[model samples]
Target: MISLLKASPAGDAVSALLDCHDRIRSFTALALRLARAHDLAEPEARDAAAAVHRYFSAALPLHARDEEESILPRLRGREPALDAALAVMVREHREHEAAVGRLLAACAAVSARPAELARVAPELEAAALDLERHFDEHLAAEERVLFPALRALLRPEDHQAVLAELRARRT
Candidate 1:
C-alpha cells in the first residue's frame, strides 16, 4: 500500500528503507549525545541505546537479508557488475551484525562510571561509520544500477505485486 503522503502507488518499500536511514542517522546523533553526557546511565541514554540496538538487531538484519536475497539477487541477474558489490556488501552486513553485538553489550554495561560507555563509544563510532558507509554505497548502487535495471525488466504491475508481497511479509 502507498503512504497517504504519496499521490501515486510507488514502491512503499523504498520509502520504508529511507525511513530506516533517517532513524539510523538520528540514533547515531543520539549516540554522540550519550557519549558527551556525564551520566551515561541516565534513562534517556539507556532508552536511546536500546532503540538503536533493537533496530540493528531486528529490523536492520532482516532488511539486509531481504535486500540481499530478494532484491540483490534479482538485480544481479540483470547487471553482472553487481556481483562484486553484492559480495562485498554481504560481508559488510556480517560486520554490521558483529558491531551491533558489541554496541549492545556496551549499552548493557553502561553505568555512572567512566569505563562503561568509554569502551562502547569507540566500537560504536566504528560500527556507525561502517553502517553509514555500507548504507550509502548500497543505496548508490541500487539507484545507479539495480532500480534502473529493474525499471526495464519488471513491468509496473510486477513492481506493485512485488511490493505488496514484501509489505505482506514485513507486516
Candidate 2:
C-alpha cells in the first residue's frame, strides 16, 4: 500500500489534495450505487450519504485552506505571473464550497426518502463530475507549474515544512 502511494505522482504535498479527490470519487460512486440499488430510505442510502458527508466535511476545508493559504501563496511568491491562475483557483474553491453545500442539503432532504434519489441523483452526479474536472485541470496546472515553483523557491526543509503543516492541521 505504501509502495503504491509512493509510486503515484500525487504523493507528498500534493497528497492531501488528491486524496480528497479520491475520497470524493469513492463516496460519490457508492452513494450513486446505493441510490440505484435500494430506495433512499434504506440503510444503505443513509450509509452512503453519511460516509460522503463525513469525508467531504473533513477533507474539503483542509484541502482548500491548504491550497489557498499555503501552497498557492508559495507558488505566487515564486512566480508573480501565476497570480491570475491562483486567483482563478481561489474562485473555483469558493464555487466548490457552494456546490458541496448544495449536495449536503440535498442529501439531508433525500436521506429519509431514498426514493427521491431518482430526482436527486443527477444533481449529485453532476457535482461529483464537475469537481473531478476541476481537480484534473488544477492538478495538471500545479504539476506543470506550481509544484516545480515550490521546489525551486524552497529548500528541502521549507518544502517538507509545507507538507508537515498540512498533516498537522489534519489532526
Candidate 3:
C-alpha cells in the first residue's frame, strides 16, 4: 500500500490525482505479478489477493469519484470538447469496477483452492490488463487535457471545494 504522506495542500487537487494514478499503476503491477505466478501457494495467494482486493476496493472508487463527481462536472462547462471523452471515462469506470469484482472473486477462489490458481491466472491477468490499458489513456487525457484546464481555470475556492469533496469521499 502507498503510505500517506503530507496532506495535499489546498489547490493541489490535480497533483493528488496524478499521485493516485501512480499508485494505481504500482498496485496493478504488483497484482499482475501475483496473478501470473505459476505456483501460488495458499498463504501467499491469500495475502496477495487481500492486498489487491483492498486497493482496488478502496482507492479505485475514490479515484473514479474524484473524476466523475469533482473534476468532470467542472470541466464540462469549461472544456466542452472533452464531453465525449468524459462520457467514455464514466462508462469505463463502471467496466473497471466489474472487472475488479471478477478478479477479486477469482483470486479469492485461488486462495481457497490452490490447485485452481493455474486455471484462474489467465482471468486475473486479463482483468488487470484491462484496467491498466484503460487507465493508460485515461490518465494521459486527464494530465494532458483535463487537469491543465482545471489548473488554469479553477479559482482557489474551486480547488478547495474539490479537495474537500475528495477527502470527504475517502472518509
Question: Which structure among the candidates has the greatest TM-score?
Answer: 3
Tens digit per residue, CA lDDT, model 2, 35-67: 455344556676676666666677667767877
lDDT of 3 by residue, 24-126 (tens): 8888887788778876677787778777877888888888988999988887855556777788778878867777887778777776776777788898889
Which wins on lDDT, candidate 1 or candidate 2?
2
**Which candidate tops lDDT?**
3
Q: Candidate 1: give its CA RMSD in angstroms.
A: 4.2
The stretch of ten residues in a row with the least summed lDDT in candidate 1 is: 1-10
Candidate 3 local distance difference test against the native: 0.78
lDDT, candidate 1, equals: 0.59
For model 1, residues 39-95, the per-residue Cα lDDT tens digits are 555666667666666666666665676667656756665556767666766776776
Query: Each model's C-alpha lDDT?
Result: 0.59, 0.63, 0.78
**Model 1 quality (TM-score):** 0.70
What lDDT is reached at residue 162 by model 1?
49
Q: Model 1 off-target regions past 4 Å? A: 1-9, 39-41, 111-119
Off by over 4 Å in 3: 1-6, 9-11, 111-115
